[model samples]
Target: METNLLFLWGTPRSMSTAFLRMMLERGDHEVFHEPFSSIVVQGRTVVGDHTVTSHDKLLRLLEERARDHRVFVKETTEYDYLSTGGDRIPYAGRHTFIIRNPRSVIPSHYAMNPAMACEEIGYGNQVEMARRVLAATGERPFVLEAEDLLDDAEETVARYCRHVGIPFLPSALSWQPGDQKVWSRTSQWHRDAARSSSFTRSEATYEATVDSDRFLYDCYWHHRPYYHVLRKWARTTVAA
Candidate 1:
């Protein structure tokens, strides 16, 4: 059977890892977490237990994997650093863009990497990728807000699964808390997510402090408009 590919792309600190974990729990698909990221960080792609450094070779490997298994991939938009061609890959798959409010995403991302650039946070890239996917498919790729997903994971994820033509397994809504070889173990964000078995509402607020950090504040405002643009088209309830 030809594999059905599903790409779940998101910005930094958007609960993407948690969502990826949910998909992994389903056991119905072969899940890949940030394949390009592993390549960029380790200078190679790890196939099964071996590593391959050639980009063309890596694509061929992925193609082979997809031929026999349903594949679910989750990655941040920051992978754009690796190639301009990243957007082209999802044209063959169903794509979903996940976003979070900059008020929350900015502070969390800044805490991890003070030197992080605005583009690295990924709001602009998410919007651009969605536009590209829409143009290529003549259908808007689903947009999911992190806050909404966390607010009601079961419902949100069920709708997402339906839109992507997947069976909505109750098992996919939760998972064991720990690291998976599929993701980068060195990432602090991934580590934090690995500690959680399920999504929970955060009471955290950063608005007051955003104005105090000049760089973060600027990036926050710069991306806020774009975030809203995507939010306007986001899929929230089933009616949407």
Candidate 2:
């Protein structure tokens, strides 16, 4: 059997943790969550079970993990910190990009971290990483939209499974509500997701208030163009 290493990359508030939970329920792949966040935010050397800080070591660890079992790693594009204007990690495997509209992502992200920078929002990094993955693998990475995934969880997830060469199991559509073993208690976003038994459409009203907050409004514009570039390629029902 061929061991697989799948990377699900996204920006904050893109429903990434929730997707990670779904993947965890598959019960076949070894799942990792936010292994690179600490390195990007704190300049730390260790994240989760992987202690090596350098990009080369991290890639080697991933390869080692996948030697016997399929590995699923859900991380954010903020790990662009590992890159110096080139491919951050040299390992080649399935890459999936999860994205949310800036209009939705910005307000929720701002609420979580009021001092968030445009760079930390990660839209540009997501795009850059996707391009690098394409150039390296000569394959277009699967692109998913959080809204679409919520709109039709089964269909969207089925499409995702087919795209990534995983078996489409209905059981992955939902999981027991609460934090998975992989998440840290420090992430408020993951905590909120852990509270859900299933994917729920975000009812948080940001549209009405986004323009009122001058700083947030500007940040939204900063991420808008980058969001559109990926949104055009996002996998939706129409594509399915």
Candidate 3:
């Protein structure tokens, strides 16, 4: 009867990784670690861009690992380019968009992947991405903020549970952002893997940044037509 799946879409620096740990720390045997990661998703089987076998094939593998217990799916990705390549499968599941103020996100993503420009991404545009989703994409994910996930953990988690059709597991509230109980070192892909406050929700809003009023911040990831794709991502991430 455990028929729920969770697909979280957002940029690299958002709290989706923390959210991943939250899902794993639970006692459900059906809920496995990230089945879509680079390791498990490809492994010896070797799945690539246009040649993805199918999520059903992946689900079968998890079911094999879990014996016969019910299995749940969990994955996190950016809003704009998710449907491309083999990521279309996650879009078929119950989904949510984890939004954080891009000010906090730019710094956090820089911390995790320091090769990008720092001025373009922010929470405001993450919201704009969500609105574009209704107009273009075939997906609709509930929107919830990283700040709320931290400040109002209980309510935020309950809302996520409600969206995914899972019973609210109180234990998910205390789930640490990077606990080993939920993941091995290989599972995490963030900078300083053990600890980094750059992803915090406290100062995530535009108000937190000095460039709030600027016409343009950074222009690497948020450029022209593709920029609208980010809005599409936000629309899918926004929770109903």
Candidate 4:
């Protein structure tokens, strides 16, 4: 079995897709892209896709895949639902969460699903998701933000190596954006957000996204102290 089975959970537009891309490029570990976790939000209905239904069967399948490898990454950010409901994830190794600024997150998340509006689930849902994962795992998995990864890809990969206790390899720095690909689960709304394009929000949208900042902060105080420190260093370097 693999020494590590990295399970990532988060909402749509949280850069989990990009992480999938990056992990695939590592060229060593076999990454399972959204295999076991299916999107089922309100309990009665499921969303997006469902190629398989049996969790135990799926887990067995994954274990077989991990039998010989050193690391296996399973990504299903939509599994934030299970975490939020106080469920335990039975898997080897640590659990991690990839996060983006909820300012950017709200618009993109709502765009993927306007039904996930703050008014319905309350603004705190995003941060609460992080809190729940940490509480359940009781391990502070590396909190890698999209901005930091984009700013320094090499350092970001290195951080992953350090956090997961893997040997730091430079190969992760340059990965071929896979040629023959699978596209069933990807959505146009997310593809647009994945770009470096600017989203000019009107006052109404801005108000809605910004109003949730407090709730986000409350849910993820674990990130704020370090975030502020990094932000200050970033500002000084950029200003020079």
Candidate 5:
């Protein structure tokens, strides 16, 4: 098990990139943004100074970094990254998750990639990943709803920091607006996030709604149940 390692696994269009950006702002942990997706989408990914070309090598690199730094990795379960052969979920770290309503997730995703496959919506994969994390860790991984995150960013993030055994950094809730190198590969999908200094609601109004697109409608219903399954364990609101 890699000590000082943490993971935030999530579904697509779930505001996870924003979450990672906050982690980057904290300046306390070494962060990786979708290292798995980088490999799957572009054949190779550069982690720090190392060029990681395979899943095994990437895992090894993360393990090495965990020895000296508190490592935070944020990734989505899209593209069947979890389905590739032997136990893919790195069981060494504390795992957490974030999710959004499919009604919102589907439409937002469709706008970015009209050819979006049902699996790319990601709730099903999240459910499976959570189960695997629980089986390995003997506890349900902390879960966050994107709605809650956007509604009360401070409270949600503070709760998450407590759950993961880190100090709540209020200042990390905001950052200077700029493009991050980590988001360059998926720049188009993250422009809004890069431009924001704080957690704000996504303003992308999509023409591809569940009401209008049969594919998106079907995809929503197909993965909606899994969303509920994970939501069952989502972090509860703290009392004022």
Candidate 6:
């Protein structure tokens, strides 16, 4: 059984990929980028170069691999795999989450997938999964706000490492700019991240966004409450 399986779940456009890139730079842990997403979204088993064909098989593969290596997984929670209700998840290791403002998330998501469903706005599913993980594990998943990460990449990641009982590696914050095979399935969504060498927050304009687009406007309100649910628990630089 894999005891070091760490999951980093987040909503779409939440800067979660950038965080995963940092993990890859760490040179430790066997990382999988949205591995379960193939089964849920594409109906395939492709995860980088491997194809396990089913959630059960994929989970087992991860478990088996964890015996000899530390495993880290980063996934967007828009698919509701966690909401389906079952013992499908391996609750043994750590489950952590990251969230971004829906005001920002909705517009960015619309830019990529205009046909995206409200659920794909994702804060709702993200929070629901966190709740389920909490119920199963008896521990609230560590939540990181994108703002905090962008504000201080070094400190935020250091905090995350401590919370998960891992060593803090300042070198992981920046990496070479290139396309990684693990990101092959959804390269377009990660264009900026693919070119970025570090955590640099871009200026996202909302002026002509939600107000001009009715769909995104609704999406923001629909998921804003859920975003706050996770946001309240996220690590911030503010003093308690």
TM-score against truth, every candidate: 0.88, 0.89, 0.59, 0.62, 0.93, 0.91
Root-mean-square deviation per candidate: 2.7, 2.7, 6.9, 7.6, 2.2, 2.5
How well is each residue in 1-240 modelled by candidate 1, as lDDT tens digits? 124777888887888988888888899888887776666667776777658775455555666777777888787776563253344564566778888888888898887777788888888877887787788888877888888777888888888878788888987677788888777645567766778788876555654347788888888888999898888888443346
Report the number of backbone clashes for model 6. Answer: 0
| Stretches of model 6 off by over 4 angstroms after superposition | 46-50, 83-86, 204-208, 235-240
lDDT (Cα, 0-100) at 221 in candidate 4: 51
> Candidate 3, residues 43-93: lDDT per residue as tens digits?
423222233244556544544444444345444443222332343443233
Among these predictions, the greatest lDDT belongs to 5
**1-240, model 6: which lDDT tens digit per residue?**
126788899888999998889899998988889977867777766543677667666777776777777899898888877534324673646788988888777888887887789887778778888888888877777898888888888888988888888889998888999988888889999987898899998665654367788877787788888888887777342333
Tell me which residue pairs clash in candidate 5.
none
Quote the positional error of residue 5 for candidate 3 in Å.
Answer: 2.8
Q: Once model 1 is optimally superposed onto the true structure by TM-score, how far is the C-alpha of residue 198 displaced, in angstroms?
A: 0.8
Q: Give candidate 6's TM-score.
A: 0.91
Residue pairs with backbone atoms closer than 3 Å in model 2 (clashes): none
Model 3 segments more than 4 A misplaced? 29-72, 78-91, 117-139, 175-216, 220-240
Estimate the overall C-alpha local distance difference test score of candidate 6: 0.80
lDDT of 3: 0.49
Worst 10 residues of 2 by lDDT: 82-91
Consecutive 10-residue window with the lowest summed lDDT within model 4: 41-50
Evaluated against the true structure, the overall lDDT of model 1 is: 0.76
Weakest 10 consecutive residues, lDDT, candidate 1? 81-90
Report how far residue 16 has shifted in candidate 1, in Å. Answer: 0.3
Candidate 3 TM-score versus the reference: 0.59
Which ranges in model 4 have alpha carbons more than 4 Å from their true place? 39-51, 74-91, 117-138, 175-183, 187-240
Candidate numbers, best TM-score first, in rank order: 5, 6, 2, 1, 4, 3
